[model samples]
Target: MFTLAIVGRPNVGKSTLFNRLVGKRLALVDDQPGVTRDLREGAARLGDLKFTVIDTAGLEEATDDSLQGRMRRLTERAVDMADAALFVIDARMGVTPSDQIFADILRRKGHPVLLAANKAEGRAGEAGMFEAYGLGLGDVIGLSAEHGEGMADLAAALRPLIEAKPEDPEEEAEADVEIDEDDLGEEADWAPTVRRPLKIAVVGRPNAGKSTLINQIIGDDRLLTGPEAGITRDSIALNFEWGGVPTRLFDTAGMRKRAKITEKLEKLSVSDGLRAVKFAEVIVILLDTDIPFEQQDLRIADLAEREGRAVVVAVNKWDLEENRQEKLAMLKEQFERLLPQLRGAPLVTVSAKTGRGMDRLQEAILRAHATWNRRIPTAALNRWLMGMLEQHPPPAPQGKRIKMRYITQVKTRPPGFVVMCSHPDLVPESYSRYLVNGLRVDFDMPGTPIRLHLRGQSDANPYKNKKRAEPSRLRKHLSGRKPD
Candidate 1:
């Protein structure tokens, strides 16, 4: 989708307009100034025209090192990535020096810029709307993003920009791949190369260098990064190729403990990160080597496992650590004990700043994803089930032996299965775990979620046709026959 960035000074209803256009409340909105600090992108629709809409932090004048200055740089990055920009201003407040500064910056960028005089509901904003003509960008669209007014004009302004975007070759190629019947019967235990972009999400705690790692991987500062904690306030997804493989990586906000999260905005940020984790096929849990495996980190890993997503643990900032061999061993040991659900998952050490050990991390991610998508044939699965039963039979609870009948794989993408048993409810949870582990080790399926469902076979009545032979006790007593 074509990217459109909404840029303006603070408190000009940028977020309001963004939510209205995206048809969702993605960006946090408040009456307070600078409510939005990070670049937020959403899929927007104006009438039939569809494009990606980015809500950037309010432009401000500050040094490069200051927080506001970093935010401005992030907004600049958004503008560079966008196909066009919507320069918004409050009609009630008229033009300010900040507005003019940003307008000049937009003009120099040479991208199509649409000046929108926002909050112009009635004649009260008429004078200021007309005053927008002095900005020299283009004709001003008197819009009320809050009331949905002037949307037709806004749509008209966007039509040309949307139509002018050049067609992407990658998209064209994806659309042109023709499916043939011969391709469907190629192989049974076959795995094809990942032709589509691999969706990956890098996640960890606050200040764990999530964005920095991604920026290093892309070989550019595509995402805003600094030493400040919680700098990333949204789940920002960027597309680039890694070692000839097309990939889309999402840099999400750092997650904090639930009890520690008090602010509403932080809560939203955490939710967004979780959503990214769910959306991704593979999740990289970036751990700061200085403070590895905090409680929150363990929780994050567990969440990924429960979500049935492939997980890879990467210990970052290895350059600063001493005794590399010793630290690596300890990290492996810690990973096993803390997150057994993700046991045997990849644990690679890397330095996002120096770009060390990143190649290993990428390989681990691909391996885990392949394993997560693995499927076992039904005959092989049943044969493995028989071997497992012969090795260690299920324990009988309350002297009622649980009979294991047959097993078959029901689906892939985590390799789920259904075991028909005599008493499925009697199957113990420990037995289920044992089967899961055996499946992992036996089939070489490691670091992927496995599901085992037990179902009991129904018994048919034996006395349905022989009613006289199976006479009721009451009938016998009433007929004066012997109860025995």
Candidate 2:
């Protein structure tokens, strides 16, 4: 679908207008200026025309040119991405110099421009509506963006340009795959389809350079990467071939802890990142290297393991460090200590700024992928279980010794196992962890969640068989006495 970007100075009713146009409260609307700090994109439909509508950073001037300049850069990128620009100006405030400045920039781009004079509900707006013509953009749309009045006029004004490209309902439906995502069932993850293009997710805490690393990997500024934290709001998946292996790469939002996610959009973004990890075969947990193992970092790593994904540790911003080798050793040591579940999993150091060690990063991902898909045979698993049991037998509970008979590989692609025995419930969680760790060490499965299940086959009931033999015993005794 094509895109239409909403751009204007602060408090010009951009969010209100965005909420109205998208028919959903996807963007937060408040009377405060500069409430929106990030570029928000949503799907919008006008009549038969379906397109992506982009809501941009509200233009604001900061003293000493703080992050506002960076915001302007992001907005500029939005303008470039859009096929058309929606320039909104307040009718009450009349035309500002900032409006003219933005208009000139959009004009040079030679893209279609639609000027809307918002808050024109009263007769007071007539003069301002007429004055919009002086801004040199023709046919200004005058309507109350908040009340949804004059939307038809707004649509009519922009219809000619977009109506020519009306979307097919089928195409529109396919573009928006509103999957529950939880519905993705347990199937062979290493099937030919998944192997054809490995799904790689770059996950980390905020300002960990997730977007920067993605930009480097794809070798395109396809993702919006800036020095400011939380520049990326959506978990964007792009298809490409990496190192001759077809791959679907996902660049996720810089994940902050649940407490830190104050906004609804950010919360959605973090959930989306989690979903990406669930679908991805290999996950690159990008650590900022500066603060090696924060609570949030462990939370992310634990999440990947829970999802049963192959994990690779990536230490970014290596160039910024003073003692490279020492820092790397410390970082790797922390990774090993804090994230022992991913033991022997690859640790790659890359400077997203300079693209150093990106090749090693990819190499590590493939190796982890292979480890995640490793399948152990039933015989090997049973042997390993025997050794494990001999080393540390299951303790008796209340004078009843628990028996573990045998184990077998139930499945693979995150290898799951089933141990059949008596008193399965008596097996403690610690012992289960011991078995899982032993399997990891012996079978070469690393950075994946090995699921183990226990089944108790109540040893055949001696009383039931004894009752059945009672009648046969009398007949046997009579026949033996007659023979004597």
Query: What TM-score, to 2 decimals, does candidate 2 have?
Result: 0.73
Cα lDDT tens digits, model 1, 1-484, are 5889999998999999998987766676777778777776666778888677889999898756888998898898889999999999999999988888889999999989999999999888888898899999889999998899999999999998888888777655654444221111211111123365677999999999999999999998777788899988867766667998867788899999999999888888888889888878899999999999999999999999998899999999999998999999999889889888887899999999999998999999999989888877889988999999999999999898888888998877667899998778888899999998999899997778888899988554778667566779999899998998
Candidate 2 has its poorest 10 consecutive residues by lDDT at 182-191
Which stretches in model 2 have alpha-carbon errors above 4 Å? 10-47, 60-66, 89-97, 117-136, 140-159, 162-199, 222-241, 244-282, 373-393, 405-415, 460-484
lDDT of 1 at 238: 68
Please give, for residues 1-484, the per-residue lDDT of candidate 2 as tens digits.
5789998898889878887877765555667577565666666766665567778887655433466776777777888889889999999889888888878877888988899999999888888888899988888899787898778887777677776666767655554443221112211112133245677889999899997898799887666666778776656656667877877677787888787688766776677678778888888999987887899989998888888888898889988989998887888788789888777778888999999998898888888888777777778777888888899988887787778888988777677889987888887888888888888878877667788999987877768756444446568687774332
Candidate 1: which stretches are off by over 4 Å?
1-3, 24-30, 35-44, 48-52, 80-83, 160-195, 459-484
